[model samples]
Target chain A: MQSKISISNLDFYYGKTQALFDISMEIPERQVVAFIGPSGCGKSTFLRTLNRMNDTIPIARAEGVVKIDGENIYAPGTDVVALRRKVGMVFQKSNPFPKSIFENVAYGIRINGLHKNKADLQERVEKALRDAALLNEVKDRLNSSAFGLSGGQQQRLCIARALAVQPEVILMDEPASALDPIATQKIEELVVELKKQYSIVIVTHNMQQASRVSDKTAFFMLGKLIEFNPTQKMFTNPDERLTEDYITGRFG
Target chain B: MENRLLDQQLDLLRDKILLLGGTTEAALHRAMQSLTERDSELAKKVMDEDRIIDQMELEIDRLSVEILALQKPAAHDLRFVISVAKITPILERIADHAGSIAEAAIKINQEPQLKNYIDMPLMAEIAAEMLRTALDAFTSEDAAVSREVILRDQKIDECYHRVFDELIRIMINNPQAATCAAHLMFVAKHLERIGDYVKDICELNVYLREAAFIKHSPNQ
Candidate 1:
């Protein structure tokens, strides 16, 4: 299994305060790796660093080497736009473009000029929707408003928008945290399906969701990477006691 | 530490399992006492008390399922529930073997004594001791104690072999003592089977403590 992204001696800070300390891990190719911990543990912050999502924070500073496909993403003169195109992100809330379902997915393809013509753009939009497992549900309503769909459908629409760019890696920050059980199940199933084409890194507070959807799990505590192992081993018999305590709901 | 609602439920589950263990251990002891004393009424009492053991197994099964479904325990808590679910049946089977021994005792008491019942009583004592220690290890979650309990099974096996040969020789030599010798042989076999069940319980104990399966492993 080849590693899609590798981080070593990664340290992150918000202004004068350090949030992550000497963090290092590998994200395997085409596999889902989940980051789990309590709130304020820096799992979400660490996830944002993968694609420079934290670059939006004026006071944030990252110092480390983040390599994707053997190229350093943090090197000087690196194209942030190209890096973000290869590493797409879906947020906790579904932020559709207030456009039709078809246009929501076509937005990324149109801006990136990924298609040859109008017909090619339509084909790419349909393919992205199909890959996100939302085509069958909203095929007839492709021209309808994105806000008209259910919460789960909108989240999948965001996923389709990310998929439209054909990223090699996808980062999701609590993707299904706001949804109900049935809707959460749909997202989880979609995640398992999406791993065949793109490596996924998801930061979730839901322990069972991580166990259900991820191939590997990384436990974070107070900005430190406590343990990283196969999901089955982590859930059944984790190597660290802190991981066990957190997963079993015994942590303070 | 903050007290969680799950901790109370887990405590109740632990109490139920310990109660079941105590009841099964007592059943094994009383069944052996009836056999050695030639007390037919005590043997009947032991046989009748098996229903309680059956009901306890059902209760444990229901509680385990509830915990798994509602609470959704993970890691050590999950392993503990699984161990209890597996161990309930083994304990019930041990009690069932004790009932079988009680039935044999009733049949053998109808005739003259066979060879003073020496080795059979010793085997029963060892099996009962192993059951007690296995239950203790389970309650304490001690893997080392579980390993020691597993090693004690060999003593019961050796005693069973000796009782088997002695009973066979007595049956061949004294034709009138054939029925009594046969019943005593079955009692010995029942004790041996109980030993194996105790070993299984100890294996589960080790799993509950260490989160590792030692059963059928060459190193264990």
Candidate 2:
């Protein structure tokens, strides 16, 4: 199901670093919203807060509400684990387990206790791989080790693993940062394809990559969201001078 | 230069400029060729080709304007399109100077080759080099090299005055070569003007560095 996540007065701190201010925005369902900025502008920090991935950090503290599908996942009795199952994540590095590729995908579903039978599990693994456009590459070698796959292949596997859980939201924290150009292109193609079935939020440092892949782009600076708009306007004619200066290789 | 896409587009535009530049360069070439050989037909070709280059300039301009309006480009994309818009017509102006050289060559073709040949071809060569490098600046986005082109225009002007002085001596020395020498002086002036335009583009890149502000003609 397509789900919209709304952030309201979201404030975050990494051991008093104060990574984000009273940031507020609405990310439309089924559209890729790319969080962009300099290295430490809270783009990735804000993305992590969407799925409550920040809670795992020992000193990371947050305030305000981030609601997905009108439900405040941070509210009392809100299951963090269940919320995570719904909002899967892919990291900058492809962290596939040193197991057969089939087990790598089945691991998420089995751990979630969401499937009833072996056939159902198999269908999910195959479907997610197919959706990621990686099924063809590893179809004949389902039992092959995921670690043996290339950087791009492993990243696509991580995405497929996220999809296998049937999550409505997938948060990618610099998913293509570790890959080469051709691999980056494949991941970008996958992100565009994934937009049809899920709401994806990606944190990227590459300005052109954001322009190429995202539907909407949000620029962050000095711990504040400077501007957020359609990708075309954000990259071409951004309203804020600070945003324009930053994107044009000015004082960043 | 390694990127075929950027290089190919730059080359197409470069070829367009040179094709346009060639007409002017040819005008200067044939003007001198005519002065040296007394070929009136070659002089006429330069004048006719100038009008044709002007028409091609207009067509190229319309096409470039259409791309900017329709494509709705972003930062680097915007930079590229805007630079093309500025670069194409500078090439046309250089062609205009070539046409003037043809006009001068026709007059000189009927008379004897004058001592004014000393600085005229040298000035044309300087102008052609400036046009060539200014285009190289556009193709590479090399602001530093563009500045070099901008600086070279002064040298072209200096050469123009030297030609003006030399031709004045020819006009006084031989009354028959006076009209032809006067025509060559204007051709040198036109070449110098083309150099000024290439420098205008060096600064034009600065204006377009942020956003494209298309200048509207008086009526439209």
Candidate 3:
């Protein structure tokens, strides 16, 4: 039960406004940890801090240590590009490249130089697609545009793209929010399967989805980590009153 | 605030369960009275009224299922619906015990009286009061009262044991009193079982209020 990622007294700010306060947690290796909270609760912001994705925002400021495998990711001279490669992200909206389906998944492989020959790259793409559970649906349509797939398929394609880089951890920010119920079920099932090889942190507004897919759940409120426990315990009987109230639909 | 309709439906479920509790309690009380007074007419009436209790249980079960299927209630709501579903069968079974007591009373009334019924009536009173208090605890969401009701079950058990020993002694001393004493023993047994069902309801009450199971007996 090794910790894949650990955050200690992590704080984040957007310009002068503090967005997260003293947030600390450890995500266990090969387990799906869900971050659940209302909108503007800093769950997504904290997720971005894991891979230093916040660096893209000019005014975003992050403080404290985020360690993946005991290495301080926030330390000076740490390669953010390589860090992002180790910790990949899927977004709320599925943003697939407008290229062919095969190319969309192959883009990460080619850029990372993860494979040797043409056949090697093709094998990597297929493996990533199969890991994402989208290979059979798009196998015959590999040459078709990524946009031609359904919203759910496109999301899976983005997941395959993330998988191609061989990330040890996958961060999903409301990965199934845009899809319908059946599609969402597919993504949830995929998350369960993916946990075998990769540590996963998912930011989800849907409580049922978190209960369905996550091993551990963290309840955040107003930029603060409120309660974190096993998903079953947190959902059935949370320690904090606020967490119980929120999960029970008494308040947000 | 999230589900106003679900809230309303839960309130309705509470009312319905309370009503069922009231009816079953009355049946127990009347059955006990019939036994002690040798009122065959009242005993027959109590036996007949069991059908109403059965129908009420089915209705409560249907309502619980509707809430489960339509609302997908979670947390306390989920516990409440589940408690209702569980408690209805318990109430139905309690009513069945009352009916059995009434049947024993009718048979006992046909024969010559063995002894004056004192402990059996006391046990029935204690069990009936436990049922009433457990239902009250359910409506008030009062775990304290549920704990008290669970604790009170021992009183009924003691009363049953006493009645059982007395009947056994009476049958041993006078062989002619065997049939009547046996019927009295069954009446005491039925009352004891009613007390156990009331304990079940109290356990469910604790589950509803605290979301925790209280496994220890009243004395324990």
Candidate 4:
């Protein structure tokens, strides 16, 4: 399988306090790769570096090569906006704007000028909603406020908004952590379905969710990548003692 | 972090699986001892105790399912639970084979005695030893011992083939001993199957230790 993103000897820092060690991994194209560890283990920090999402933080800085399709994204003169457009992100909290459902889905398309006309924007919004598995739930109420929907629906809206720009990769940081089990199941199923077209990188504290949604799993600890293997192999028999200890609830 | 409750539950499950293995192993010993010692009453006792083994299997399966559903265990814990769930049925089948051997013993004791047991008793010894070692490997989580038990299964198979040829020779030479020899052959077959079940248990022990199955693998 072709790699969608590759990180080699990557390190991240926030004002001299290192958040990540020499992390190196290759996320295969159109496969779900999960980053799993405890809070502050650098799973999320490593994930944000993929699209340069850490650039906004005042003290955040990164070194080493983060390549997408053999092009170093951290090289000089690289457009951060275009990188983010190609590698969209969803967050732990479902932060849907106080706009209508259609507008929420259409927000990215309009900002990027991705559509040629109003009809084109409408089609793209519907397709994104369908891809997010939320079209039928709110098709009749596209004009309704995004907040009117439940937390899970709002999260899917955020996912649909990410999908609107046709990103080649989607990075989800605990996308369903705030939702209930059934809602979480829907999002997990949607993620599995979306992998057919887009590569997915998920950071999750829920080990079961990572096992359920990801084809490949990376375990992290103390700012280091401890183990990377197929999800089944990682869950069944992780190589490192720390990875086994953490996954078995023995220690973290 | 410690999930004390899950850890305790898993420990309890391990103990229960050991108990099941012990019960089945004892039943096989009693069954074979009855056959070899010409004790029909002891054979009847082995037949009666099969129900308890069945019940133990069901209880183990129930606990395994509960742990899987409630704890969502991963890594070694997951492998252990799944291995127990699989090993339970294999042990139950071994107990059933023991019961069959007991029945054959009862039937053979009613008939006129054939030539004294030779390879059949040896086969029973090997099968019982395999079960004991396989259970030991399970408790110790020793793949090395498991690999030994897997290789030991072939010894029992060789003993079974010898018992078959000797029984056929006895039947052909002495026409009156044909029914007795047939019953002995069935007993040998039951013991052979018990060996197979023990090998299955050994394979599960290997899986629990290594998280890789060696069954039907040419490389192993």
| Docking quality (DockQ) of candidate 1 | 0.63
lDDT of 1 by residue, B1-220 (tens): 5337778878888898899899999988999889888888998998999999999999999989999998889888899999999998999999999899999999999998876785988898899999999999999898999999999999999999999998888989998998999888888999999999999999999998888999999899
Look at candidate 4 and tell me the lDDT of residue B19: 93
DockQ agreement of candidate 3 with the native complex: 0.45
Q: For candidate 4, lDDT tens digit of each residue in A1-252?
A: 999999999999999999999999999999999999888899999999999999999999999999999999999999999999999999999999989999998999999999999999999999999999999999999999999999999999999999999999999999999999999999999999999999999999899999999999999988999999999999999899898889888893
Tens digit of lDDT per residue, candidate 3, span B110-177? 98887687588788889888998888888898988888888888899899889988998988998988
TM-score of chain B of each: 0.97, 0.76, 0.95, 0.97
Kindly report which residue pairs in candidate 4 clash with one another: none
Question: Which stretch of 10 consecutive residues in model 1 chain A shows the poorest summed lDDT?
Answer: A243-252
lDDT of 1 by residue, A1-252 (tens): 999999999999999999999998999999999999999999999999999988899999999989999999889998999999999999999999889999999998988999999999989999999999999999999999999999999999999999999999999999999999999999999999999999999999999899999999999999999999999999889999999999988898
2 against 3, candidate with superior TM-score: 3
TM-score of each: 0.97, 0.62, 0.93, 0.97
lDDT of 4: 0.93
Model 1: runs farther than 4 Å from truth?
B1-3
Model 3 Cα lDDT, one tens digit per residue, A68-185: 9999999999999899999999999999997999999999888888999999999999999999999999999999999999999999999999999999999999999999999999
Candidate 4 or 2, higher TM-score: 4
Candidate 2 vs candidate 4: the lDDT winner is 4
Q: By DockQ thresholds, what CAPRI class is model 3?
A: acceptable
